[model samples]
Target chain A: MPTVHVQLFKGRTADQKRAAAAAITEAVVATLGGNAATVDVIFHDIERHDWATGGKLWSDQPPAPPTPAAP
Target chain B: MPTVHVQLFKGRTADQKRAAAAAITEAVVATLGGNAATVDVIFHDIERHDWATGGKLWSDQPPAPPTPAAP
Candidate 1:
């Protein structure tokens, strides 16, 4: 069994989440040959204060909106 | 909007995925004040070859089963 974890700054709509989940699940099950029943997904909304990259917390970065096309 | 991504080695029942998704969605919505619609969860099953930690691929590590209690 394979469990995939993804981490990104949060910003999406409910419909987008649903679409992404369904797409990802299907991709994993069919393309990856993973059992559909064994797929597990979790999302964690991170605060800029809690995230850091290059020695700077995300909170210190400029505020930005979601870019659906990026993912 | 906050997008939360979670990845782990795969080995979960369909029921577990459903339960986890619901629980996580609720936690994000209630505890974090995130919108239910924007909560996205995606799972990737890692091949021992594809995942690495501490310079060792996961596949090289001992084969282990899921420890549901660990999170």
Candidate 2:
């Protein structure tokens, strides 16, 4: 059994998780030769205050700019 | 940078997390020769229903017996 652990910022919708789990399972099965039913995608939601980079907490830093919409 | 991700059953207290993080950071630094300040220990609290082993969900199984107290 192949288990994938994904760390993500909190606030992702259930729909997002569902889509991600399906896509990840497909990719893992295709690339790693595992059964789709045996694949597990576990998500860990982290808050900004709990995550840090370069000695600075994400909560203390300026928010990232929003992604631009494609034309 | 070395990042340690720990997945555990939910309901852990903040004090437990603090102790775990400190101990894990110390171990990683001692074993791997990394700065304690640069090490990251992330805890992921997972629900029983979300985790499965041997084709069975943890929530569907009987609760684990409590650990024995020290003599």
Candidate 3:
């Protein structure tokens, strides 16, 4: 069983998660040779205050530019 | 930098997360020769419906017995 943990800034919709879960499962099965049913993709939505880089929390730093919408 | 992802059933208190983060950081530093500050321990609070084992979703299975309190 292949378990994947994806960490990203919070606020993604359920639809995003659903699509991601399916895409991830497909990748894992294609590359790692595992059953799609057995692959687990868990998403961790981390708050900006909780994540730090170079000793400064993301909440304290300048906000990152928004991600471009998918085609 | 070493990053750790911990997946467990949801509903744990903030104090529990604080304790777990400290303990896991210590373990990683001691065993893997990493700086404690650089070790990221991200906890994923998984819902029962999102997790499965043996082809059964945890939410669909019988309730698990409560964990005994630590001394």
Q: Which candidate number would show the highest DockQ if scored against the true structure?
A: 3
Better of 2 and 3 by lDDT: 3
Query: What is candidate 2's lDDT per residue for B1-71, written digit by digit as tens?
Result: 69887789987766566666767777777898867778876767789999999999999999999987455
lDDT for B28 (candidate 2): 79
lDDT of 2 at A7: 87
Q: What are the per-residue Cα lDDT tens digits for candidate 1 across B3-54?
A: 5454545655676566556554554454434356766755444456877868
Better of 1 and 3 by lDDT: 3
Ranking by DockQ: 3, 2, 1
Question: What DockQ results do all the predictions give, each relative to the true complex?
Answer: 0.10, 0.11, 0.15
Error of 2 at A59 (Å): 0.8
Better of 1 and 3 by TM-score: 3
In candidate 1, which residue ranges exceed 4 Å CA deviation?
A1-71, B64-71
Clash-forming residue pairs, model 2: none
Q: What is the per-residue lDDT of model 3 for residues B23-66, given as tens digits with 9 covering 90 to 100?
A: 99999999999688999999978976555443344666699898
Query: Number of clashing pairs, model 3?
Result: 0
Model 2 residue runs over 4 Å out of place are A68-71, B4-71
Q: Which ten-residue region of model 3 chain A has the weakest summed lDDT?
A: A13-22
TM-score of chain B of each: 0.69, 0.89, 0.88
